[model samples]
Target: MVPMPEQSPPSATHDVTNQPPPLAPYDASADAALLEGLRREGAGWAEDGVRLLGLRAGGTEAQEWGELANRHEPELRTHDRYGNRVDEVEFHPSWHHLMRTAVAEGLAGTPWAEDRPGAHVARTAGGLVWGHTEAGHGCPISMTYAAVPALRAQPDLAKVYEPLLTSREYEPGLRVPTEKRGLLAGMGMTEKQGGSDVRTNTTVATPTDEPGVYTLRGHKWFTSAPMCDVFLVLAQAPGGLSCFLVPRVLPDGTRNTFRIQRLKDKLGNRSNASSEPEFDRTVAWLVGPEGRGVKTIIEMVNCTRLDCVMSSATLMRKTLVEAGHHTRHRSAFGARLLDQPLMRNVLADLALESEAATTLTLRLAGAADRAVRGDEGERAFRRIATAVGKYWVTKRGPAFTAEALECLGGNG
Candidate 1:
């Protein structure tokens, strides 16, 4: 038996070849399109910050953080060990780290707090840069950013929460609003039977003895960022469908009746938690004039739609970069893939698309900045352009990603 022992097979079959190196450690802000658009759109003051964020986002550490956060996803804790209803969604530590960086970098609602000329434009540039690292965590950040304008509908409520909401501190947990260094907000509009038709919502909000307060009783089908400190919810009030601010914890530090029925099993955005929450006797404060829930929440919606456009552009840019990097290093048919005419054409087309998206996104950010500064013409332009851009850019994302992925062959 010892004499019959055979030699091991050669290891050449396992050797790696023609593989593209990892795409990290590259400067994301080096994009000529983004930098040019930033200056042209009046956000040139933000170039330094955007470059810093771009460096961090493109580093290997941030890349690993994004991978780990998505891989771990979020876990729903509906109850404590003692059978107490906790209704908490626990995220991986990596998720928290990404969130901390985002908040510290003023990627959320900080623009509203700043008195600079191009604060919104700067914030938008920061978002576009940091968002390249991870997309899921941007949900809470965007909601917090959008919540400020809608919150302004009720001046007193805005006074109490706006500062905390716009603060750069990233405090997690359902603490009393006044006690937290900062706060994040979520939205609960789509109901089980209603979906986008919010007017069909059956959630009822009965007035409390205290003026401007009510108790909500209904279920939300898609309540994203369930762990946020507060939510802007739509419910049927005595007057009609109205908007209300629902805090997770009361001022006295008691948890609200935000029953997390279950976490959604989504096809993507796994790191962000979406839930079906039942608001049984959930205390809420009216946000605007009664029977004007749509009008009140539309401000938040418009802001989020702009973010959607930015997000779609981010995905396109990321995928295009990946494809270009892969083709440059990979070889096939006796030469480097990138030098091939067909592959070069594909990459050139993708680059054009990416540049267009980036330019349009930054232009819209400029419009938003002007609109906030009381430019009626800019406001009107944004109202139509945002919706159109969101539709076209987002709709083009899947196809663009698909084409870019095809360039990577099996590796993608």
Candidate 2:
């Protein structure tokens, strides 16, 4: 009553109205360095693919799909309504849309399918573009892409899987590979007992009546993309550690012994499912020769490692674009942040870092193609460059992302 007698209303501030709207219509592949570098490095064949990704990145649909996929993390369904063990991972519709888009865009195994010159470079470029949208889905896409070379070690398996791997469709479910329109491949190598070293892995693979058939008995500490139709798993054989191709559905359409023990609660990559599974006499087909599992899967590992380089470069470029866009709109003091000398220098420095990373990653991608072509120099370069690129680029990624986020100040 005393306050009402003063006849003064409480102060009202429209802070929300004063806030800046989000930046949009950003073409991720329009980076001058990326386009120019791809052209100069003989990967211009991927221009169309990169441009398509640019369009998607700028479009509201793709951005919303990425956001929704992240917002709705995958859920693990170990059983059905009747308590039947299904061991399925359920993802939002957005995740399937993203996966389908990625697969249809040839971001997975198109290079291997086409087998043309500059395939790896083209695929790597496409990967960089697609990876920028949402990184979690890249797991299945990456493993599918990487599995090609390793699958080649077994011609029959390659014959059966290659076509499905390259298909533009993204069929999600636990079904026989022969009945699906498309397929994704997963890998299981790491275990709780041994993270990177497969030497200590104790999962046993017992040979069956069939020459190349075996039964796997052990657990996989990490089986990424559990929804995939097939997994290239490593287990102990009579000849020591070996690689085997394990499928979710058996040949008779019945579910295999593959049991999803639990899904890891990872801090990041929440949109993707990484699970722990126990296998009791899981049916598997031998890949490569006995006792050569490490050597066989090493090809797949190397491919994924190079992908890590491209991914790191892509992350840096994405962060820079976001920061630059924010600075152009936001003002500090009396002038726009973009006009400030210190902020300008910081932005320029970040751009340079991103450009360098892009250049180096694309260069290494080129080296991979040349290495495949039997160029001694490139092969030698790739051997050392892969290790160095993977190490340095990944090492700089976290710091670069942090600095770029800092540019947005409190908004970030």
Candidate 3:
């Protein structure tokens, strides 16, 4: 938590007209622009913040995502037991479209917008793209387009899930857009016992060889996104872990073989769904190769992690800016809070640090952009670099948020 600067008493000679009150009038425009922009380009999102901070634009996708995350606060009230929990929150389809536009628009001027048209698809009509999205990196959406090669490269979803994402649905199955309303119902991953450690998972998938031939037999505790059409499950195979593309819906309109065991009542992000589920001979399609389960799952996981970092980081930055404005305008005794020697110094201090964090994040993202374009050296160092960053920015964000909340006083 950021320590609040000392508040001084008002001075006697202070002219009421010279200084205005400190309470920040709610301004939606500023927060909205940054957030809406984040769904576009990362550094570009913080370019405005950098100018304000008097630093260069260097923040990462994580930082930009942090700012956007902050934008959700109005939507997130407190959860006494859960602490900063929100009852409900979701992205509107239009929100995705805006991000896509930002990508195209952003790329026209910047270098990181490789997936402009793809980004546009994500922004323009993402929700409908996939039902019960697995994770954040807009993977549920991006994969809708990205995994196409993997999807079509093999006979996998090419005849199945592919058409669902595009305007056409290959004759009989769920459509993408309507899939959004399909409420996942449940998921199938691991438990406290293990997550990525699929080897420790007790869930089992049996083979029947009846064309699509498959059956699930086991319990999946802590499947993260289980609120849609069904799930893409992973289970231990004789050779190793295997990923099965499982559907939540069945032919008779009956629930799929999967059943919800419980919903985790989380502390911070109550709006995001997390659950434990059971699968009883559930029908499914194997994704990628049979024994290559771990590899396939990583693809999905990577997508979510990226999106998560962006969203979390976006929230933090937005909160930081709002707090700064609040402090700058509020006054204690004679002068505005921002005019205080201590407050000004701290604000200056925060400006440099936060901007530095933002820039660093962006540079990493740019590096990531280059890397994805195939830049390689010592891969290990990149993660080491990421660790250096995640630690700094994530920490400072909350500190800034705490300061901002405190700055708002009882109003917060």
Which residue runs of candidate 3 sit more than 4 Å off their true CA positions? 1-155, 162-188, 251-254, 364-392, 395-397
Per-residue lDDT for 1-412 in model 2, tens only? 3454444445543334324566555677888878877776677977987887877865678778888999999999999999999999999999998999889888787777775667778777877777767789988998988888898899999999889887778899999888999989999999889977888998999999999999988998999989999989999999989889999998799998889999999998889999999999899998899899999999888888888898899899888988988888888887788899999999999999999998888888888887877889998999889989999999999999999999999988
Give the better candidate number (2 or 3) by TM-score: 2
Q: Which stretches of candidate 2 lie over 4 Å from their true place?
A: 1-12, 15-19
Residue 167 displacement in candidate 1 (angstroms): 0.7
lDDT of 2 at 238: 96
Judged by TM-score, which candidate is best?
Answer: 1
Model with the higher TM-score, candidate 1 or 3: 1
Reference-based lDDT, each prediction:
0.93, 0.87, 0.46
lDDT of 1: 0.93
> For each candidate, what TM-score against the reference?
0.98, 0.95, 0.60
lDDT string for model 3 (1-412, tens) is 9999987677854656533343222232233333333344333433343233212111233234323433442122123365632222244333333223322222111222234322321221112111111113232333332233333323655565444433211112232323432122122557557875766877776777664456878887776545335356677665567777776665555446656555566665433445566777777777667777767765444333333333334545545565676776677888777788977776766555545554454444444443444448523444456556665666666677676667556766
How close to the true structure is residue 305 of candidate 2, measured as C-alpha lDDT? 84
Residue 38, candidate 2: Cα error in Å is 1.5
Q: How accurate locally is residue 178 in candidate 2, as Cα lDDT from 0 to 100?
A: 83
